[model samples]
Structures are given as structure tokens and as C-alpha cells.
Target: MLADAEKNGPKPAPLIEAFRRTWGRMIIGIGAALLGVGGFFLMTTFIISYGTDELGIDKSVMLNATVIGSVVEIVVLVVAGRIADRIGAWTVCAIGGLVTMAVAFPAFWLVDTGKPALVYLGVGLGICALSIPYAPIGAVVSGMFPEAFRYSAVAMSYNLAGVVAGFVPLLATSLTGAANGASWGAALLLMVIAACTAAGSFASGSLMRRERAARPAGDRVEVAV
Candidate 1:
């Protein structure tokens, strides 16, 4: 398998050309990655803090909620991937983004309600929404670039998202403090981030469709160079 892959691997020159051709779409994908991954980090970082400090919930209960939410996310990830395969990755991602955005305020509200069960439900729902975009995002980003540049483009975008994700926790915490322990600001920020991801997903999807339509019928399918 390794030998066969190497035989058909992309050439350097074509990889460069592929990057040049798809740079715009790549940018959109990177933007989506930043938001999607950052939002995930933001939620994970603050759920415990908010539950204990602001909502007066027990630490152990919050910890259990996080664990349960993670388990639900894993299951949702698989289901989301299967759905994306049937519909379209971008569509699934966009839908997920909308759901995440819609749920942000309510999730925060539920957490602030100071009910343990509601808090668990809110966290679980948020995780499910996060999984929707996440599951198919790998394929969606890779599809934005030609096969020749897929690896490089995907890696760069993903790493950039990681950088954003690393900071989101601190940022959310600061914002929450600034709002006098109110979670609405933090929730709003997440909603805005999710919106960016949704917009980017739609834009990248449109670009891919255009590229596909522009290809000549009899022309050789562009492989990895």
C-alpha cells in the first residue's frame, strides 16, 4: 500500500499549483476551523467553572456532567459523519453551526438556572452540536483543495485552528469575569464564532461546486498532479 501510494503521490510542482488555485477556498476553510475548534475549547474550559462558581452547583456533579457530555459527543460524532456522507459535509456543518448558535444562549441560561440536571442536559446538547461540525470538518476542509495540495492545506488549517482553540479558554474566562460573572457574554461570543464557521462552510462549498462545474467534460481528471 505504501509503495502504491508513493507511485501515485502528488508532485511538488502540482502541489504548489493546487495551492495557488485553491488559496481562496483554503482561507475560508481555515476561518471555519478557527471558529469551530475555538468554540469547542471555550465550552469545555468554562462549563465547570461556571457551574461551580456562578451556578452554585457541586464540583462533582459538574465533573460528571463533563464526562457524560464527552460520551454523548463521541456517539454524536459517528452519527454526524454518517449523515454528512449522505447529505454533504458542508451542509451538515452549516446545520450544526446553526444548531450550536441557537443553543448557546439557552445552554448558558440552563447552566445559570442552578439545576444540576438542567446543567447536564445543556452541556450534553452543546457537545452534540459541536460534534456535528467536527465530525465532517476534516473531509470538508480537504475537499476545498485539490488532491495535490490537500495534505498541506488541511494541516495548515487544522494547526491554525488549534492555535485559536488554545486561547479561547482564557479569553472566555476573562470575558466572563468582565461581565461580573455573567455567562451571556461568553455565550454570545461562541454564537458569533459558530456563525463564522457556518458562513465559511457555505462559501467553501460554493467554491468547490464552481470548480467542479468548470472542468471540461473530456479532460483527464486532475489527480494529485
Candidate 2:
């Protein structure tokens, strides 16, 4: 029966129809990705420049700090992935976003202090916050749609977010300049991005439950990706 369905399943809905059916979750996923990945870009892609130019840290030191953060993030991604599996992806992601938002300003302050140890501590905190949600996002977003259109929905949302997030470094630069070289400007950007992710996480969880409830038991599919 499964093989027959694979060979003879109804053609996937048209693009517009797919979007109409799953727009709620797709929009939530896109918002979450835009903010989550935007925050990640602000921290990773732009942090070196921000630290060196705005905060007066050495360029080499900033580079080392980034490398250290990446290493720490690898560990965090694994742990967070495991935790998301046991508890729930959306729950973990929402918590991560709130924590990131809460720490954004303080993290920047630590970096602004120009002390090497404190700088590392601040950067590590930001990376950990982003990585926690980053781990399980693929699973959450891909699971939002039926199997027939899952790939298109997830890919479109993810890539759309990436396109916007690519500009984060430039936006952060402008924000910092607007604030007269104040790190708070950039920190504020991160806070907003984190808040979006947190809000989207909550919305996505609700939509997931509704989608499941609306489907007949036989039509429900457990998605791994």
C-alpha cells in the first residue's frame, strides 16, 4: 500500500495552493528564520568588525574569539539537539530566543569593556543562545507541512530568511553609526531579532497542534526532518 501510494499518489498541489494551505506555519517559519539567522549573522559575520572597530579590540583577538565561539557552538548544537528531541523543539527554541534577548545588552557591554576574558564570555553567550534554536529548526520547519509539499515549503522559507539575513551586517553597521558608535544600537538589533524568533516559536507550536488536529488520523505523518 505504501509503495502504491508512492507510485500513484495524487500530484502535489500547485504552488499557490500549497502556500494557501500552509501559509500560517510557513510565515511563522519564515519570521523565525529571518530573526534567528539574522541574529546569528549579527553575532558571527559582523562581530569581528564590531569588536575591532567599535569596541577597540584587536582584530586578531576578535578572530580568535569568533573561532572559540564556533567551537563552543558545536558543543551546544549537539546538546540542544538532544534536548529538543526529549522535550520539544519549539519549546527549546522559544526559551533560547528569550534568553538571547535578555542577554543581548549585557553581552555587548561585556565586549565593550575591552577585557579579553570578558569579551570571550559575552561572545560565547550570544553564540550559545543562537545555536540552541538553530539545532532543531530544520526539523520543526520541515515538519510543518504535509509530505507532498514539505520540501518546497521548507526550502522557500529557509532561503527567503537567508536572503534577508545576509544584510544584517550592513544593518548593524548603520545602527551603530546612528547611535554614535554606541554598542547598544547593535545590541538592540539582536534583541529585536531574538524577540521575533521567540514569538514565532510560540506561534509555530500552536499552528503545528492545529494542523495535526485538523487532519484525519490516517493522513497524519510523523516527519523526521
Lowest lDDT sum, 10 consecutive residues, model 2, at 10-19
Kindly give the stretch of ten consecutive residues in candidate 1 with the minimal lDDT sum. Answer: 216-225
Candidate 1 segments exceeding 4 Å error: 1-23, 214-225
Query: Mind giving the per-residue lDDT tens digits that candidate 1 earns over 1-225?
Result: 346468987355744665687667767887667655787676677788877887688998888878888999889889988888888888888888888899989888877877889888888877778778888887778767755567777777788778767887788888889999999888988888888789888886876676566667774354210
What is the lDDT, from 0 to 100, of the residue 64 in candidate 1? 83
lDDT of 2 by residue, 1-225 (tens): 457578898555646666877777777888777656888789877888888887788988777877888899999889989988887788778888888899999888888888989888888888878888888887777756776667778888898788878988999999999998898888998998888888888887776676677788998766422
Taking the candidates one at a time, how many backbone clashes does each contain? Answer: 0, 0
Query: After aligning candidate 2 to the native by TM-score, how far in Å is the CA of 20 from where it should be?
Result: 3.8
In TM-score terms, candidate 2 sits at 0.89
